[model samples]
Target: MTDLIPALRHLLTLAWQCDPRRLLRAAAMVAAGCLATPLIALCLKGLTTETLAGRGGSAVLLGLAAAALLVLELMMGHFAHLAYFELGDLGEVELQNRLVALAHGRPGLEDLDTPRFADTLALVRDDLPRTRASLEAALQLGGLAIQLGLTAVLLGLLDPWLLLLPLLGAVPVLAGNRAQRLLDTAKESAAPHQRLGRHLLDVATGHATAKEARLAGAAPFLLARHHREWQAGTRLLGRAHTRAAALRAGGQLCFALGYAAAIWLVVRQAQHGVSPLGDVILVITLAAQLSLQVGTAIQLLTVLQDAGRTAHRLDALKPLTPFHANKSDATSAPLVLTRGIRLEHVSFQYPGSTRRVLDDVTLDIPAGTALAVVGENGAGKSTLVKLLCGLYRPTGGRILVDGVDLAAADPADWQHRIATLFQDFARLELRLRDNTGIGDLDRIDDDAALSAALDAAEAAPVAAAVPGGLDGLIGRSYGDGVDLSGGQWQKLGLARALLRRDPLLLVLDEPASALDAAAEQTLFERFARLVADSRARTGAVSVLVSHRFSTVRMADLILVLEHGRLVQAGGHRELLDAGGLYAELYRLQARVYA
Candidate 1:
């Protein structure tokens, strides 16, 4: 109960932020609805009394007045729904937008990988709108309160004993409060179960895991786990709901008995000539009307409690402030890395990991040069590329572009001047043009530039094969779409990287892993030609990571890493002559082909 107040306040704040006018209108309509309810009860009493008094014309006038009140009530109810719906829609949209922004602002994927965070995302995405509607219903509790107060006052004028009738209905409202608390506790306890279900669903449905599941025959194992989670969640929900229903039913019975007692007392008073027929009629009518109002209030309160549980999930996200760059550095023109890229004693390890991925590694690359990184698996090859692209920061050193430390450089500005094709590249389920255009969305529609990029990346064949050329859809899940082979997908990814207009550096991490030997050879030759063209156009540097020694041999400089440390750095022939780790590994790979 203590936590509920703050949560409700927060939801109200979010609602106001979405649209103040709509909220105000909804509130006004609800107030009007409350007045309409009392007006309806008054009209009912007047019509009954006038007909009993044998005043035919007066009864007719009272009937017409009651009909008018009914019409007004109906109108208010309709408009209230409209206003509430609008507010709910706006609030849901606002919450979703804020949640997306908050998720993206997380420092790294570490925060996103937590089960708690995942649960929060699932609830926010799936339950926010329902919660918003629940909140609106809860707000109508004020209208019910107004109607209850009005009914009590009118009944009191006839006889003070009738006031006790509404007090009897308060029993059920108190029981509802208890039920709400229990439901909230149950939901909070089941959060972990919900998260487990979400994890199972992700593993079952994810594209990357689909092939592995089939090959390993693991579908049944995963399905069993999913079913177990669902069963556990269902059991918890069932117990909570059953308990709440029992309490509510008991309270409702007590209220009903109290109402019957009140009516019997009114009848006894009329029999003794202490109260008139009209007065007895008024008392009975007010009691029933007020009882229904209290019932509605209780139900609305329950809904509000349920919505509050879901709102807490969305409230977990924290906001991030914009990054600050050093003011001492002057803002350069569009291009900045004119001289070279340099890493000075950089060291980094992933979160919660003891082993370092990159340890005091240092290197430099002049503008227009091709640097190749070669190493066996687990040698920090991909980690280096991530750091270079500013996706992750070094724990202990600085990366400099043109002598300016990247930490002090604006991240957005640095990203604008770089392009990367990671090994785990995104296969966006969008149009062919959008897949490539995402590399540089600003100039993606430029046909001449697009054509040039496609040609240079050896992607022209795949593009021509697409049904509608660049405009064709590219995913199997959608209509009229075609899926590409692994090698063809790699070429499309290369085309994406090549489409960048002002990239000062290009990082390719095992870019040809999917291609066959002959296709890789031809692709590398075209890649070299494109690099030369790109360098001539914008003086961009290229950093390639590969296990193939033949590919690194074509680079201006080759770097060999062992156990997170740089073991050898030189041109390929120089490293070969030195007979170090690079030379031994190169010969080992060379023998595979021989």
Candidate 2:
């Protein structure tokens, strides 16, 4: 209960962020309702007594007051619901948008892969709505507190001893607090169940895992595991609910006993002529009503306590810092990489890992020239491309784009001037035009530009096959959709990279991996033609990462990496003549296809 206060405060903060005015208005309505509760209760007692005393006109007047109180309660409840819904909706939207922005601005992909960060993401995605609902519950609890306070004041006025009857209801409040603790313990125990549930959901819905599950015939096994997790969660919840019911029953028994005691006191006082019958009746009636309100307040507080715990988890997201930007006015205007893009004494290790993926890697690619990066698996080839693309800042040293330090450059602005095709590129489940056009949204509606990119990537056949040409849906999951083969998908990805009309630097990582030798040659030929055309127009730079030595040998320069260090840097023929790591790997691959 004590821990819950901070959580409640945090939820209030989020609510305030949504719309402070709405919250205030809702609170004001609840306060008015609370102020009216005693009046309504007293009016009922007075109307009953007046009717019994043959004062029909006074009874009629009191009846009208009761009717007005009922109308006010309804209005207050309506406004409260409206405010809560609006606040919850706004908070959920803000939280989701902030999370997406944070994910995009994360310095590296590795940062997003950590378990703790993933857990935080899951909490935000799945638990944020629940937490917001809990906040609404907390607000309702506040209204209940107001009602309880008014009831206490009215009962106290009737008889000082009757006030003790409301205090006796605290036993039930304590019982509810105990039940809430048990519920919290149950939720803690179900954490593993929740984790398993999430894993099952991933396996069931993920595209990549479906093929493996079908081949292994493991759907039944996975389904059984999912069921087991659900059962475990339900079992914990059931046990907690049983305990809550037992505690509530005990509380109700205590409350009943307290009411009986108050009734007996009122009767004894009336018999002793210490109080008039009318006053005794009024006191007894008020005590019963107050007891009911006290019970309701206890229940609401328990709910608020549980909500507070959930709210605390959501509060952790409040301090998520926005992406940092360079203060200096750095224009993203096109600049010639005359001395080439250079990495000087650069090193990088992913967070939580001791092994450095790139170590003191110094290299250069001349402006308007092509460079190919080739290495064996785990040889840090891809990490180099990431560093060059500014996806990851160096752990040590710096990357210079035509002598301008990339670290001091605006990341968002700099990224705009580069086009990238990652090894694990996304296959957008959108229209063909959108898939390519997202690379350059400004020209998304330009049919000529879209057609040019498709032609440059040798993806004209794919575009022709689509029902609506560029406008046709790309994935089978959607209506009127068609899925492409792996090689065709690669072509589409290349088309996307080509769609970036103003890209000064283009990075291609295993872009031709899915293509056959003939297709690869044709694609590379078209790519060369496009680059030659672009060079004639703008002198754009291209960087390729590939395992195919034959494909890379055509590059102006080749880089060989071994165990996170640059081992060879020269033209492909020059490296072969030098008989270094590049030559050894090239010969080894040539032997396989000999």
Candidate 3:
């Protein structure tokens, strides 16, 4: 009930922003149409009275008036639709844009990984289609309120007891609201299971997993798991819906009693000649219209409430976004890393978890230097990279880039000066050009830049092999699209990363993991040269993460992490000479290849 008014206001605001003229016209039409219902009933009563008195002229005039009111009701509603339809469409687009901004507009990426945020996002996405109807619902609810008022006044004129019908209508409205709340709770509870069910369905049906599922003979297992999740969610929602229906039925039953009593009272008055037959007709007509208005109001309330929840969910996400980390008067990042990056006792843990992913660790990375990080999986390598990229803030301590606090620097400015390639890079189903060009949106269409990036990543051959070269589509989801192999995709991702020219900090986190050993070595050599070129131009800093010792030894400094701790840090030869974790792991890998 509290959310209802705000929801209507939001719809009106959206409508006004889209087309104020249309909104005003729609409201006028809806009001006129709603008034016609009670007016038509009034004419029906007048026509009955004149017919009873055998006044042919007056009866015919009243009959024509009733017909005109009926036409007004139908025509006004139709005209309202004509005006509101475009407003609804435009409002839906505006809502979707707002949702998109809520999801990705923040500087930090914390909310993207949160389950609650994901649930809200899913719910809002499902609500998007109903945005069009929500506008109409808001208008209809206002018109219904007016219609109910007029009906109540007419009933009061008939008899004081008859006025109770409108009050009785409240029973169903309250019940409907309760039912909506119950269903809302059920839907929120079922979201996780529904999401899991959909994931399994995608896994079972997706082209990427089809071959593996066939070889593993896991189709039946996946189907059974999907069915379990789907059934779990379905059962919860089904029970809520059943209970809601029963509550509605009970309320309507209570209203039905009042409706019967009012009609009986009016009929009795006419039977005893205490009131005219025309008054009985009027009472019956108005009472039936009151019943219809109540039901329509319930349906409209349900639509409005659902949209209200979506708006509330969107509002809830605003605080979760990390905009507070950004300063209104932010300082610009350094154009070059003269003093390099320094991490002082930096530590991090995810939002709700206590277990630290990156424990208190201090390190310095000099400008124009190549630094390598090596560790087994789950050693906080990626978390460290994320912090460096300003995608996250440290739980303890701060990072300084060339003596400027990274946290205080403008996130957009810092991001613009850095480039990265992570292991699980995006496989965008776009044209080959866009797949690579998206790395630098400003230079997406720069052919010279594209060619250079392709050459640096050794992806020129891959692009040439495609039907339309860089313009060729990259996924089978679209028509006549070309699909690349795993290694080919990695090369394209590397090309995308390399497309960003003159980055102040270059990060390649296992960027060539999918390629063969020889290919990986070749790619690393090309990357080393690119790093050297950036360093020469702007004293850049580069961080490389890889398991291959052959690749790790190329770095000017190497840091070994174990269980979120910096266990060893030195040059390749110095670390080997120190004869600790680095030496042991290097020897073991050396033996495997020997």
Task: Enumerate clash totals for all models, in the order shown.
Answer: 0, 0, 0
lDDT of 2 by residue, 1-594 (tens): 575677578668878888899878877776776666667767887887798799999999999998899788888778877877888788778767766765564555655645555555565566556655666666776776776677777767766777777778787878888888888778766666877787886786578687888788888888889989988988998999899889978987898888888888878888998865666666666676667676776767676676565455445433354234444655453554455677899999986788889999877666778888999999999898888877888988898887788877777777777888888988897999999998888889999999998988889999999898888998887776887898999889988888887677888899888888889989788767766665555566788899988889778888889999999899977998999789999999999989
lDDT of 3 by residue, 206-260 (tens): 9999888889999999999999999999999999999999998988999999999
Among the numbered candidates, top lDDT falls to 3
Per-prediction TM-score, please?
0.84, 0.81, 0.94
Where is the poorest 10-residue window by lDDT in model 1?
A: 319-328
Query: Model 1, range 424-532, lDDT digits (tens) per residue?
Result: 8888778888888888888678777787778878888888988988889997877768878887888889888888866888888898899988889987887787678
Q: RMSD to native for every prediction?
A: 4.0, 4.4, 2.2
Candidate 3, position 448, lDDT: 88
lDDT of each: 0.78, 0.78, 0.89
Ranking by TM-score: 3, 1, 2
Q: Once model 1 is optimally superposed onto the true structure by TM-score, how far is the C-alpha of residue 539 displaced, in angstroms?
A: 4.8
